[model samples]
Target: MKNQSNMPLYQLFVHPKDLRELKKDIWDDDPVPAVMKVNQKRLDIDIAYRGSHIRDFKKKSYHISFYQPKTFRGAREIHLNAEYKDPSMMRNKLSLDFFSELGTLSPKAEFVFLKVNGKNEGVYLELESVDEFYLAKRKLADGAVFYAVDDDANFSLMSDLERETKTSLEHGYEKKTGTEEDDFYLQDMIFKINTVPKAQFKSEVTKHMDIDKYLRWLAGIVFTSNYDGFVHNYALYRNSETGLFEVIPWDYDATWGRDIHGERMAADYVRIQGFNTLTARILDEPDFRRSYKHLLEETLQSLFTIEYMKPKIMAMYEQIRPFVLMDPYKKNDIERFDREPDVICEYIIKRADYLKSELDLLS
Candidate 1:
C-alpha cells in the first residue's frame, strides 16, 4: 500500500557504530527523549517515524529533510545527510571541492572513518543539512541556455510545457533562430572574458575579471577528459519569482576513459558531436558568439600558461584510475573503449583549438 500521509518507513543498513552508546547518553537520562530508539541489531539500523520520508534519494548522494518530534530537545526542525562506503573517501571530498571551486554553493560534508562496530576498514561521510528548495520548470526557448545529451533527451523530468516544446521540436518545427538570448551560456562566457563589466554578469556574488582562473578550470575538465559536459548533462535552476539562478552539472561516470588513455578518450568525435549541435543551436546568435568568443580567448591563454592544473588533473586521474580501470575479468566488457584512443584525443584537441581561436581574436 502506498502511504500518502507524507511519512514512510525507510530501511537503512549501517555498518554499526557508537550509535547505541550515543543514543543512550542522549535519551536514557533525558526527561523526554528527543529520538526514540526503534530497532538496533548487529550492523543493522532502523528508524520508525523518525523524520520526514526522503523521495528521489539514491545511493552515492541524497538530500534529506527532518523535523524534530515534540519530545526532542532544543531545535524545532533539523536536517542531516550521510555518504557511506567509500574506500578512499575520495569522491565525496573531490565533489565538494570541485563545486566550491566552481562557485556552486552546497552543504558542507566531512569525511568520517567508521571503525566502531568491531569491524575495520569501514568509512562514511557526514554532511550538514540543507533546506528543500521548490523547483520550477520552464520550456527551452530560442537562444535558450539549454543542454542536449549525445543520445537521450529524457534526463530531467519535464513539465507539461517543456514536454510539448520537445515534442514540437522533434517534428519539423524549430524555435525561431536568434529570438532569445542563451542567457546562462552567456553568463558562463562572460566570466571567461576580459574587460567584461561586472554588473553585466548575473551572479549573486562579485564578478571577478579573472580569465586565468577559468582557463585553469577548463584545462582541468579537458585533462579529466569528461565527454558529457554538453548541454544535457548540465543545466541551470532559476527561481522565477526572484530571477536568481544557479547552474547544475550532473553525470560523471562517462569520464576518465579507463579502458583507453586520456588522449584517446578525449578525441572521440562521436562523443563530442554535441559540440556542433551546441554551436548551431546556442552559439548561433551574433551577440552570443561575440561575447563568448572574448571569454574563450582569455580562458585559452590562461590554461596554456598554467602548469599546475595539469598535475592536479594527473593526481585526480591516479586517484580514480584503480576504481575505474579495466581489469582482467572486465576485459570483455571494456575492450571496445580500448580500441579507440584517437576518438577521445581528437575531441580534446578540437576543444583546445576552439578555445585558442577565440583567444587569438583578442590579440
Candidate 2:
C-alpha cells in the first residue's frame, strides 16, 4: 500500500476461505472472523458487509466488532464506509462534525486508508458506532439506542411502504441496546406523536422527547439538505436520566449539494421544514415553530457559512487528495473530486440564502 499520505492505515487479514464465504453472500448479516492490524497491534474482530444498496458496489463498506477485552479507541464496534457514491468522500464526516458543532449528538468520524491482505482499498471513513460504548464515552447515562433501518421508521401511524396504517409502531427500528421495556418507550412516543390532541400535543410530546435537541438535529439536516435524513437516516437514543428520545445523524454522504446518486442537487431541494411525522407535529405548535425558526436563523448567521465551512472543507480535501488520487476506485473521478470543495461552498451559500427567505414562513 502507498504511504504518501498521513492518514492512518488499517490492515485486515482475512483467511482466503472466510473471504470467499463473505463474498458468496453480500447480503448476509453474519460476520466472518478476521484480524485487524493497526499501529503494529493485531486484534481479533468480526467483520460484516454493511449498508443497504452500497453492498452491491464494487468497493464495499464494513462493520467491525472487536472481541471481548479488545477495543478500538474505546469503541467495541466501528463502521468503515467506502462512500462509493460520493466523490468528495467528506460529506458524511463534514455533516456529522457540523452537527456536533451545533450542540447536537453526532458520531465522530475520521479518514483512514485500509488494506485487505496487503492490497490497497484506498480511503475509507472510520465512524464511531452509536452504541453502548458511545454513551459511556460521553459520560452519558445508560439508555436505549434504536436504529431507523428504513423509510418505515418515519414515526408515523401510517406505513411508508404500504401507504396504510402500520401493523406495529416499531416497524422500521432495530433495537441496538436496552431491555424489553425500552421498546414501549419508543412505541409510546410514536403513538403520542400521531394520536395526541393538537391542543395538548406540545405539553405531552415535550415530556417524552428533548424538543430542543430534536430541533437542532432538524436544523442540521435542513441546512445540509439531506432529503433522506428526516425519515430514516438517524438513530434514536432514549436518555435514561431525562427519559427523552433524541435523534442522532447517520448515513449523510448524500448531503451537501448532492443526492444519493452523487448528482448535483439544487440548493432548495429540502425545505426549511423537513419531512416526517415527528417533525411535522413538533413544528405544528406555535412555540416550537418559533424556536425552530430562531435556531435556523442563529445557525445561518454563525455556522452555516462558506467563511465558517470552507477552511474545514479544504483541510479535509487537501489531507485526503493525495490518497484519493492514488485510489484505484476513485481514479476516474479525480477531476470531480478536486472540484468538490467549491461545490460544497457554493451549496452552503445558496442554501443559507434560501433558508433566510423561508424563515418568515415559519411564523
Candidate 3:
C-alpha cells in the first residue's frame, strides 16, 4: 500500500555483489542507502538486513551504519530492531536498563519510527551499536579488540574439536577493531579454561578475565532468563589498556520468558547452574558461587522485583503503544500488544520467586 520511491547514494560496495552477501547462499544485495527519519529530521545512513532467523521473517530487523557523516549522535553504527517477537517491545529495553542500573556497560536504546525513503517501516527500537565508537564513548582505550559471539560460539576450546583444517580466530567471533596482529587473542584463554586443573581455574582465569564483571553479567542473564545469551547474543573484548576480557550484553529480544524463535519459554527458563561451559565452571568455585548467590538475592530484593519493574514496563508500554497501534508491519495487533505487559508483569513476579527458590536450593 506504500511506495519506497527514492534510494540515496551510498549504495557503493568495494567488494563485488556476490562476495558481500551476509551469507554465501542468501542476501546477495549490497547495503541500500536510506535517509533514516524520526519525526521529521533525517539521518544519513545505509541500511542492511540483520540477524539470522529474523531476516527470513517478513518483519525484518536492520543494521544501520554511516558513510559520509560517518557518525550519528556519537555512534558509528546503529541497530533498528523489528522487536518482532516481543509483543510488548520492552524486553530488550528493560534488560538493558536493568544492566545499566547495575553500572554495567550496556548499549543506549531509544524507541523510534523508521520511515524508509518516506515509507513508514513502523516503530522500531534504535540502539547504539557496539564498536570502537561505543568503547570510546565510555572512555575505553582505542585498541580494545571487540568480538561478537553468536549461536555458533559455544565457548568450547575450538582446538580440541575435530576439524579438517585450522579454524580462524574470527570463526565464531565477528571482529570489530582492526588489530595489527592476526593472531587469535582469546584462544589461549579458552583452551586453558577447559584444560586447567579445576582447583586453579578460578585464579588462572581471573588473571586474564574480569571475573567480577562476568559474574554480574551471569547474574543478569540468569535473572532475566535470557536463555540464548549464554552461548551467543554477547560481545567479548580484551581491554587494550587492561588486557582483561569483559562481557557485553546483546539481543535481549529472546529474553524475559521467551526463546530465540519467539516461542514462550517457562517463566523460569534459565534457572539451572550449568548454562554454559565457561561461567558454569566458575560458579562451581565456592567463593564465586557465594558471590553469585548474594548478587541474585540483592537483585531479587532491589532490582528484579515486580514492584520496581512493573512501572518501568508500564512506562515503556505507554510510549510505544501509539506507534504499535499504527505500525503496519507489526506481527501482532494492538490488542495482543496490550495483553503482553500484563503477562510479562506476572512473569516477572513469578520468575523472581522461582529464582529465589532456586538460589536457596543452591545455597
Candidate 4:
C-alpha cells in the first residue's frame, strides 16, 4: 500500500479510449506513445475475447483476457491476462520475474507498471506478441497422455467428502460403511507428477539430466506455499523441434500461506510427492519412484540452501496478509488459526527441511 500508486509504465496497459483520453488530458505533459494497441472491434462483442491486433493498430500492443480467444488475426496481439482480479494477481505478475531470474523462462513475459482508475494497481505484465514465435499448426501423434487431474468428474472429491461427512452425522450412518469410498476419493484427488518409464513414454533427457531440475520446479511452488495444481494450471506439451514434452505450470492461488480448506493446509510438494500404492503403481517401477524421491529431496535442499525464498515470501506476506481476514461467519470456523501466522510459516519451513533431509540421505 505504501508505493502501490508508483507502479512502472511497462506494467500498465491503456485501452484505446483510455489512451486517447490520457493523451488529451495530459497533452502538454509527457505521455508514453502507445507501443501496444488493442483491437476494440474484437473486444466489443465477446467479453471473453479481450482484443485482437488490428493491422491499423501499432505493433507491440498487449491485451488482458480471462479466457482464451477463439481466434486472432495473424497471431495478432500479445496478451497479459489478469483474468482474476484477486489477491494473487500481483504474485502472478511477479512469477514472470521469478521465472526470468531462474533462467527457465519460455515465452518473453514480465510485469510492467500501469495506472488504472484513480488508484495505481500492481500486477500488470507484458508479453511478446504471439506472432513473434512460430505457433505449431501440426498436431503431435496422439498417445497415452499423463495429465494433472482436475476436480472429480461426478463431484469434486473434496465436496463429496464434506457432503458425506455431514450426511453421516445427521443419520445414524457408520463411519466404516463409507470409509472405503472416502479413501477412494482421496486417492483419486492426488495429482500424477511424472510419467512412467515405458519403451514409448521414455524421454532422452531422462538419461542425461538428473531428475533434480523438474523436482526443483515443484519445490519452488512448495517453497512459495502454492498448492493449487489443478490440470488447467499446467500442461506438458511436446516441443515440435525437440519432440520432448516439458512441464508448464499455471494457477498460483491458495499459495504463500493461504489455505482454502480452512484447517486442511498441507505442504504443496508433499501433497504431490507423498506416495501411496496407487501412485507408486501408476509410476510403474521402483526406479521411477526412487528418482522422484531423490528429486523431491534435492528440490527441498535447493530451496532452503541460501534462503532464496525469504525476501519474496515475506514481501508477499506483507502485501496480502492484511486482506486474508476471515468473514464473520468463517471467523468462528478458523478461530484457532487466528494470529497464528507462524503456523503457516513453520509448516512451509519444516516441509522444506524434510525434503532436504530426504535429499541428504540420497546423497
Candidate 5:
C-alpha cells in the first residue's frame, strides 16, 4: 500500500525494560518512563495504558503526561485513543467537533499516526486533555473539573452497580482539579437534583447548572446516539465565576450510529429527553422543557441534516482513508471502513427523522 497520509506523526521511544513492565500489566494505572519525539523534538513523558475495556484490546489507548511542568501543545497531558472498535475511527473527533459547533465546551481532537520504537502503531485520535490547561487554553474561568468515571456518576442518589443507595454522593466522579470544597459543592448539587421539590426544582437547579449548556450537550448525545453517554462518558466543570456546573463531552467513539462494540444502533436508541437525574429535573419544568425542545428542533433543521453534515463526514473519511488502507490493525475492517461515511450520513437522516417524530412528546 502506498503511504499517502498527511496526518501528524508521533514517535514514542521507551526503554526496553520499561516497555516490558508496561505490557506486563495493561490494567495497571502506573506510568512508565518514555521519550516522545514529535516534530524533531524529544520530551520526557510518563505513559500508561488508559480506558477500561479498551485496555483488553490488542491495540490499546494511551495516556501521556509530562514529567513535571512541561507541556505539549499547551496541554500537560493527552489521550491517544486506539479507536479499535470504531471502523471509521473518526466518530470521536466528529462527535466532539459537533459539540463545539453547538457552542458547548468540548475537548479538541485530531488524527495522528503513532509509531512505537520505530514500529508503526497506525492511526490514533489525539485528544486534548480536559484539565487546568484546557480552561487556560480557552480562556475560560478558573473552575474545578471532574470526570464521570462510571455509571454511578449518573447524578443520582443510588449506585449504578448494586442499585442500592450510595454511601457517598460522589460515587462515580474522579476529581481532576479541585479542592475539598468542590467535592461538597458537587454533592450538594446532586442532592438538590434528587430531593428538590417539583415547584422549586427549576429555580434551584438552574442556580447550580447552566441549563442551556446542559441542554445543548444533551442534544449532542441524543443526536449522536451514544447510549452510555447519558450516565457517564462526560466531564463536569464548575465555573468559578458563574458558580454553575457545565458539561464537557468525552470518549465518544461509541457514537454515530454504532454501539460501544461497533455494532449498528437504531436511530431511536436514545430518546429526545436524554437521561439522568439532573437532566430529568431540568426537563420537568415547562420553561426549561420548551427551551430544550426548541434547541433540538433548531439543531435538527440546521446542523443534523445530510446537507450540513455530509461534507464534514466525507472530508474526515477521505483524509483518513489513505492511512486506513495502510493501517495493519484495520485490515479486517477495510470494507466496513470504506462504507462508514455513507452509513453515518444515513444515520444522521434517520436519527433526525426519529427525533422529529418524537418532538411531540417534549411538547
Candidate 6:
C-alpha cells in the first residue's frame, strides 16, 4: 500500500503543442509523445489523457506507456488516476486494498506527487495497468482474453439482444487482444446467460465462470456501495485455465458511500440484488441467493469492520494529509480533506450493519 521505490517521482515535461492537442482532443486514438524523467532516467514515452468523467478543463487523468518496451517494476504502463472527486485521495487505494482483502484481483495502487513541465499537479494515484504484465504478475497465462467493460456492458442481456447485429454486443467492452476480428466469445456468453433455462442455468453458467467468486465480487461491490461500478469500471478477464470470465473491479473513486462529486449518498443506497442483468439472473436461483446471503454475512463478520480497517485508513490519511493540503490544484474544500477519512471510517461501520439488516429482510 506504500509507495514503491521502483516507480520514481514521475517528473514529466511535454511539449506545449502536444499537451494542448491532447486537451483539445481528449479522446484521441494516438498518444502524445513526451520526455518523461523518472529517477533521473529520460525516456521517450507516449502519454494521453484518459477517463470520461475526470477529464477536466484544467487537470485530467493520464495513461502512460513506455515507448521502448521498457518497464518500471515490471509494468510497461501505469494509470495516473486524478481523484479529483475524492477529497480524501486515499479512497481509490483503500478501495483496491479492500478488494484484495476480499480475495479478488485488483490493480496495485500507490500514491505519487506529479509534476508537469515543472509545475506541480497535485497528488495522483498511480495504478497498475490491466495489461499483459498484470496477468503475468497474477501468475496467469500470457494470452488470456481481457476486456475493459465500459458503461455499455451493463450485464443486461436485453441490451445486447435488441441489437440487429453482433457488432452491437461489443458496445461496452474494449478487447485487449488487439484483434478486431469478432469471434463472438463474449456474445455467446451473454446469450447463454440470458437464454438458458432456469432449471439448468446455474450449471451451464458455472461451466464458464467461478460463480461463487463472481457472486462474492458482486456482493463486495454492493457492500462498498460502488453504484458506478455495477455496469462499468471493471476488467473482465477470461481465465486461461477455467475458460470462464471473472470480474475484477476498477475505478472506485466513487465507491464507499460517496457520490461522483464526493458527497455522501444515502446509507442504504444500492439494492441488495438485481443491479445488473447477470447478477439479477443469478440471484433468482434460490441456491445462489443463499450463497450470496452467506457471503455477505461472512464478509461483515470477517473484514468489514472499523477495527479491521481503521488502521489502514488512518495510515493512508497520515501519508497523504500533507501533500493533499498543499495541492493548489485540489478543488475540494481544504477543511474537508482530513475530515472525510473519518466519514469513510463511519461508512464502513454503517454499511456493514446495513447490509446485515437488508440480508435478513431478503432471507
| Candidate 1 stretches greater than 4 Å from native | 1-225, 231-235, 240-245, 256-264, 267-279, 303-306, 310-363
Alpha carbon deviation, residue 98, candidate 2 (Å): 0.5
lDDT of 5 at 101: 92
The TM-score measured for candidate 3 stands at 0.86
Each prediction's TM-score against the native?
0.39, 0.98, 0.86, 0.46, 0.98, 0.91
RMSD of every candidate to native, in Å, equals 14.7, 1.3, 5.4, 14.4, 1.6, 3.0
Give lDDT per model, in order. Answer: 0.32, 0.92, 0.71, 0.37, 0.91, 0.76
Who wins the lDDT comparison? 2
lDDT by residue (tens digit), candidate 4, 313-354: 456544433323311212232434344345445665766655
* 1 versus 4: better TM-score goes to: 4
Model 6 agreement with the true structure over 1-363: per-residue lDDT tens digits: 125322236788899999888777777747898977777778778998878867763668899988864887788888898888887877788888888888787889998888889887878899988867889887975444455556568765545334533445567788765333323666677778878988889898887667877886887788788886777778777765677777888888887768888789776888777387788788888888998888888888888888888888888877776676546677356678768878888888888777777886547
* Cα lDDT of model 3 by residue, 1-363, tens digit: 122222111121323442245444345335656565443345666767787777776667778788657776688888878888777788898898888876567888877765543445676777787778888898886654555555445566552244423265445677777464523557666667768899888888887778878888888788777877777778876776777788888878877776776667797667647376787688788888888788778888998888898889888888777666657876357888888888787778878878867886557
Enumerate residue pairs that collide in model 6: none
Q: Give the total clashing residue pairs for model 6.
A: 0
lDDT of 2 by residue, 1-363 (tens): 336657998999999999999999999999999999899888999999999999999999999999844787899999999999998999999999999999899999999998999888989999999998999999999999999999999989999988999999999999989989999999999998889889889889988999999999999999988998987899999999999999999989999999999999999999999999889888988899999999998898899988889999999998999888767799779999999999999999999989998998899
Quality of model 2 by C-alpha lDDT: 0.92
TM-score of 4: 0.46
Ranking by lDDT: 2, 5, 6, 3, 4, 1
Q: Quote model 6's TM-score.
A: 0.91
Clashing pairs for model 2 are none
In candidate 5, what are the lDDT values of residues 1-363, reduced to their tens digit? 124756988999999999999999998999999999888888899999999999998888999998754997799999999999998999999999999999899999999888899888888999999999999999999999999999999999999887999999999999999889999999999998899889888789888999899999999999898888988899999999999999999999999899899999988888888988878878888898999999998998899999999999989988888777657798667898989998898899899889999999988
Per-residue alpha-carbon lDDT of model 1 for 191-244, expressed as tens digits? 333233345432312232122232333333433344444333333333233333
lDDT score, residue 336, model 1? 42
Candidate 2 regions with alpha-carbon error over 4 angstroms = 1-5
